[model samples]
Target chain A: MKKLISTPYLLWMAVFIIVPLIMVAYFAVTTADGAFTFDNLAAVSQYANIFVRSIYLAAIATVICLVIAYPLVMILARIDVSFQSTVLMIVMLPMWMNFLLRTYAWMTLLGNNGLINMLFGLFGLGPFRMLNTQGAVVLGMVYNYLPFMILPLYNVIVKIDKSVIDAAHDLGCNNAGTFVKVILPLSVPGVMSGITMVFVPAISTFIISRMLGGGSNLLIGDLIEMQFLGNSYNPNLGAAISLVLMVIILLIMTLLNQFDDDEDRVLM
Target chain B: MKKCLSKLYLALVMLFLYAPIFVLIVFSFNTTKSRSVMSGFTFDWYVKLFHNELILSSLWNTIIVAVIASLGATILGAAAAVGISGMKRLPKTIVMQGTNIPIMNPEIVTGVSLMLLFVFFMARMNLEMGFVTLIIAHITFDVPYVILNVIPRFRQMDPNLYEAAQDLGCNGVSAFFKVVLPEIMPGIISGFLMSFTFSLDDFVVSYFTSGTTQTLPITIYSMTRRKVSPEINALSTIIFLVVVAVLVINNVIERRNLRKRGVVR
Candidate 1:
């Protein structure tokens, strides 16, 4: 009976997730010339610039998300429970809408003649070239991924004991001291999760870079996308790039996990 | 003093977070070719949007995909959740972690990998990519989310109830139906809704798998790439409103349930 109930899920997983991932691993090894060579792995060095740019941009976006999310999460944590739920709902509501629509909306706001530039013009600041820049790419990424950062932070922050803060105060720690030494140290888990969540997606995101950054700022995701759609028709190269990107992501996550472990040990 | 400053900062952060959505909603009702400002209020864009055959057809396609995929995912996820709950500790942990891998992986990776699989399959079987492929891809991603949502509820459920039912001479199937199903219904409903929303909103996976028949997001993507249209804004605004309404309704139902159980004031 249990097996009967579990069969469908097991079948779906085997056919879809496991099989597709195995295919990715297979394709990553094969060359465009139909030869099974490690040449695809060598192609990684040629696209070094794109990999660096993706990491740099993702790092910037992750930092911005951390900064923005920290205060918002702190506020949400300190608020009444009902208000916290409402704020959480509001934060998550954007996720429910179409991601493409959200990205397009960013375009409408940041384009040359878009609303933000128009507003600047009205304020006598004149139009600034906000679109098709690394700044714009980061802005779009931070906007899209802010909630991912906030939710985890909020989850961790809300669980933090208020008595801990009070105890810090009792120990002659100033507000800043308490925040830095106590609250921040305790919130490392949230910070790590938020960073992982933001950095991973931001690094791999193609649409935001394409739409908002135009043809100027190229990320690894854009390069992979170009291989498939733009000019290069090499599925092997695309697979290779994806595999490299996957490794970089895995490395970052492992580093973050190590950091988290060290922090946990210190706290303990 | 610090608290006051933090509160002010929080308000500004909220403004930043909501500003783009607010702009989108405002522009949806604007009566102009440009999306810059509100010239005048009009329903023209909404009317025009409703008239677009491609948009309407894509919307219909999206609805069908989301419904079917959500239903499929919910069934699979619920069964998995139930099965996992009945498992011993080590196997349960293994299954739980295995299911979570898809969720943790990037959407692009999932999208491209699935596209490659479909391409490989098509080459082998000569089958075309369309509804069937899209449904398969959607189910792939959607089931994990449902499993994540359902597993906790299953864990939290009292096990003695099942034993009690069994001791009363009911067989395992009858015991589960009478005992376990009722208790896990809320989790199942929430999982279904989560899966439905996810399938409805997904673009990347659908974009890869959806051959010629575009989903609503793909349709909007093509339209926006061509030209900026207030009709897109109108559609987005309507979709946003629907999500908000659903969320509020869900909250209300949850609150009512809490009140019924005397868990809240």
Candidate 2:
């Protein structure tokens, strides 16, 4: 009876998610001519630097997101209820503007002869170039992905019982000690989720790196895109690379769900 | 002193976030084509945006796709959620994991795989990729979000409410609409809004499956490869103001809720 109601969505899921994944795996292990070979998967070894660099940069971005989001979330948690929505509105408003427009705006700001450098020129600082560098790319990543980190962290911190902190003070603990021992531990789920949310998109991102880092740097996303869109035009190779990325992401998401499992247990 | 420090830090972060938006809005009205130095103000770009048929049409396309995809996903997802909510543990797990697979997957993978599927499907059917494929791709990805939102509301509702409605002379369909729908309407609305946001904001998936149909993001992307135009800034400024307006309206509604609850006036 239930299956009858679920039939349409089940079919949609099967056609869209299941079949497409199987096709990717099949493409990964086969030659373009429908013959069996693992060369597509083998070819990913050549772009090992791009893969490693992608993960490394994503990690750096995630760490930066954590650092910046923590204090901000703490302050957001301390705000009054009526004012909280207004603050959150500001945080989210930038996100609503087109993503490409946001990235393009950073190009103007971080461009060699951009506004910031022009301001520096007035102070006799002589325009230190900030554009088309790893720092620019990281700046873009953190700027774009920071809100994902903040929202999760803010929700978790906001839910921490105020009385628990009071009890810690009564037990002769300082604010720093109370935060470290009581608040931070309680926020593990949020931290885990925040890290995963930021890391996944950061690692997978091609746009920020492309716009900010220029051609000198390439991430896995760029490589995958090149296989399909660039002169390479290798669907099999793209599938293979996507397969590997999918596995890494699947593992990361497993960790995310592990954090959610605690929330689930509490709800149950 | 600590409170002041925290406030100062918040101000700095806010500046970081809005700096680009500031540039986007300012450059829209610039008399010059420069990105950095804004020379003077003009309404020419906004006028050009209206006159540009391609941009206007794509804006229309983007909104239509978002609306249809969100509505379709909500219906399919809400039904699926109701069914899944009544399932055994193992089946429920399997279905849920299946639903979430798309949500959990990298967007590029989803985009590429769907592109490949449509290509293959079209080759077999001797058809082409266009509007239908794009909408299907959107709904495919969007359904998971809707299901995730609605299922929680289903769980939170009083389980026996449906039974009570049936006891008071209602059939299954009527009982569902009368008792269950109102309870979960908030979730469904939020789910629809989420789907709309994802559909509208998406670049990769739309880029892959669009097949020559331009959305606003694609139009903006192509613009980036060429000379940076001030019209983009005008379009962005308009979008920014619209979003801010929406949030302000949302805030007013929330404030009214607080007043009714005796928390604020």
Candidate 3:
């Protein structure tokens, strides 16, 4: 029976994960004409514009999430424990709901006859084009991923000892100084995790761009999706792009993991 | 002064977090076609939503997919967790990290990769895309979550309990069934719930993999694209309520357990 149960797990890992990864690596190296070529790697250079846009958008979204989530985390950290849990629940509730539905809700709010434009109309302002703009894309990204940013930052912030803050106060560190020099440094792990969580997924998300940015904003995720389901049928090129994205994600995660270790040492 | 400002910030952030959902729920009862006005409330949309066969069938499809995929993922993940617990350290670390890849990787990457794999298989082997392919993709991603949940519980288990069960003359299989299974049941339940929620809410993977069948999310996407209809709003409201209820129930159970253990008053 032990063997029976264990064998299925071994088989699952082999067939689903390891084999597919091996196939992806093989596809990344091979050309469409079935010849072993470095052309796929070279092809990545030609798609430089897509890669840049992906990084740029992800960076912008990460900054936005950090800016918004930091204050919220600070507030949660200062609050009583019961209120902290309630706030955390409120933050997480949307995440638990269908992500697609949340995106759809944003679409509704941004559309021509949507709520925001309607408010503008009430102010005698004409129908403003807010839906397909870069702002809309950023807004959608922040909305969908804010919880991911908040939870981690909150975790680290809550773990910070109050005595440290009191000691900082005794040493004449004012509120702003203490926050910048002490709290921020201590919460580096949460910030790093927040950035990684938001940046990695935000860069690869095509749904927000497709729904909110209205086909104009072409993210790397959309590019990959296009290769499969859209007009482009080049799985080789798609694999190449995926490999590049995976590498970039690994680089970011490694940076964040180092900070995670630092945070652990601080806690200890 | 700083405290007041921080409190104000908290309120604003909470409002931003909730405003979209609040608007969606309220608009479900709007009488007008437009979403702007506070029109007279009506249950017409909810009535129409229930009568829509397409939406109903899609909901059913989503439920079926989530149930089957979550069940499969839970079984596989639990088995993998138990197996890994007994393995050597290096191999266990590698396998554990590998399992977490699905969770850490972007949904789009996973979706595109699986889509490409299916297309390649279809062209090469003359296979078709349908329920089986969707289930395979879901299980592939969801098993990692289950394994992550269950493995910690297994690690935390007292090894002596298993030895005592063995000493009581029970066979290994019977001992594991009676002892280990009971110990890790909560972890299994949590993992199952996590997988179920993930499978139900997944859009990108399902969108890429589903050839004919439309899940609830896909249907919602299609409807939202056509027009901002109250039917979609009603559907969202229903889903929101159900999710909140499930979470509340889970929280209550957890709190009760904590209280029983004297960890909380």
Candidate 4:
């Protein structure tokens, strides 16, 4: 009786989720005529710089987000309890807004003749090349994904037992020592989750790089997108690239999970 | 002094977050087409937004897809949760892991994989990609969220409630309606709303699968590639307002519920 209702969805997953992944793997290993080949996988190595750049930028963004969000979230956790929800709502409001629009907002702010440049010009500074650079792409990622990092960190930190911190203090630890020992260790799960959430989307984003990084900073996502929808038109190559991306993500998630004792919380 | 410094830091961060949104909202009222230069105040773009057929149609498409896909996911997810609740450890773990795939995988990968699936099958099946394919893609991504939401409610539910209802002379189905349904309604509602929001905001999967069917995000994507226009600013302002309204109302309702429960904090 319990099995009856779930059967439809289980079948749905088999067709949609499981089979489609198998299809990606299948296409990754085969050529256009359905003949088996390892060439597609080998072809992906040509874009080694792109993969590295994507990882580098994404890692930088994730680290920046962690740095910015950690202090802010800790402060937020210490705020007056009655006002916390309203403050959290404000923090999350941008996240609720359209992703494209948020990124587009930055485009306007960072353009050659943008608001920031206008402000700088008033102070006798020449316009800096802010947009269409790797820095802009990282900034976009940090801006868009900061809330993701904050929310998870806030969840874990705010829930940390107050007595733990107090006990550390009572046992001759200074404020900094207590934070480094008790608070930081307890927030590892949050940090792990926060890193994963920000890093995954940041690494895979094509739009941020396109809109902000312009033509120069092509990431792995752009490469895959080009093969499928853009001018490149090579589905097999796209599949191979995607397969590699999945493996990279799986590997990172595995590495992160090593720090997190709670297996269920690990996205993998 | 330290408290003052922390508050100042928080204020600066909040400013960074809100400054762009403020710029967009302010620019939406500008008479000129420029994103940066606000020449004069006007309602021209907001007026133009209403008359833009493409934008309106895409908005309509977004709504239709969000509503249908969310509803489908809610039903499918709720039922699956109920079913999975009674499963053995192995199958339950397998199903749960399968459900996590869409949530864990990058949107690009999910979009590519699904596009491949549809493209491969559609060639032989002779089915064109459009609204149906778009909804299927949305539902596929949305169901896992619903299951994640509903399963917790199932775990929280007292197992004896159904038996109690049956003992009081209700049939199994009727007992579910009377007892179990109300218990899990909050989870289902949250799941549906979450799915709806995700579908409404989704661009990547829809981009790959929609073919000719343009949703609002897809439309926004194309628009962003063009020169700056106040119409987009106007549209974003409206979207921002709608988000604010929804969140505020949800907050109020939650507060009211807490009050009713005599747990006012």
Say which candidate scores most in TM-score.
4
- Candidate 4: global Cα-lDDT? 0.92
In candidate 3, residue A12 scores what lDDT? 79
| Cα lDDT tens digits for candidate 1, A40-92 | 77977997987888899999999999988888888778778877787778777
**Which candidate would rank higher by DockQ, 2 or 3?**
2
RMSD of each: 2.8, 2.2, 2.9, 1.5
iRMSD (Å), candidate 3: 1.9
lDDT of 4 by residue, B92-166 (tens): 999999999998899999999999999999989988789999999999999999999888898999999999999
lDDT of 3 at B10: 81
User: Which of the numbered candidates is closest to the native, going by highest lDDT?
Assistant: 4
Worst 10 residues of 4 chain B by lDDT: B256-265
Question: For model 3, how does the per-residue alpha-carbon lDDT over A1-268 read when each residue is reduced to its tens digit?
Answer: 5545656877877776777766777788998777897788788888788788778878898998999999888878778875667677877898887776788788878878888999889899969888888788888899999888887888888889999999999999999999988998888878887887888889999888888988877888888877777798788888888888899889877866865666342111
lDDT (0-100) at residue A14 of candidate 3?
75
List clashing residue pairs in candidate 3.
Answer: none
Model 1 chain A poorest 10 in a row by lDDT: A259-268
TM-score attained by chain A of model 4: 0.97
Question: For each prediction, how big is the interface RMSD?
Answer: 1.9, 1.1, 1.9, 0.8
Q: Which one wins on DockQ?
A: 4
**lDDT digits (tens) for residues A186-262 of candidate 2:** 98878887887789889988888888889888989888888877788988999999999988877867866764645
Candidate number with the higher TM-score (1 or 3): 1
Q: Quote the lDDT for B205 in model 2.
A: 87
lDDT of 4 by residue, A1-268 (tens): 7679998899889998999899999999999999999999999999999999999999999999999999999999999988898899999999999899999999999998888998899999969999999999999999999998999899988989999899999999999999999999888888998998999999999999999999999999999999999998999999999999999999988988887786435221
Candidate that beats the other on TM-score, 1 or 2, i.e. the better one: 2
Which CAPRI category fits model 1? Answer: medium
Better of 2 and 4 by TM-score: 4
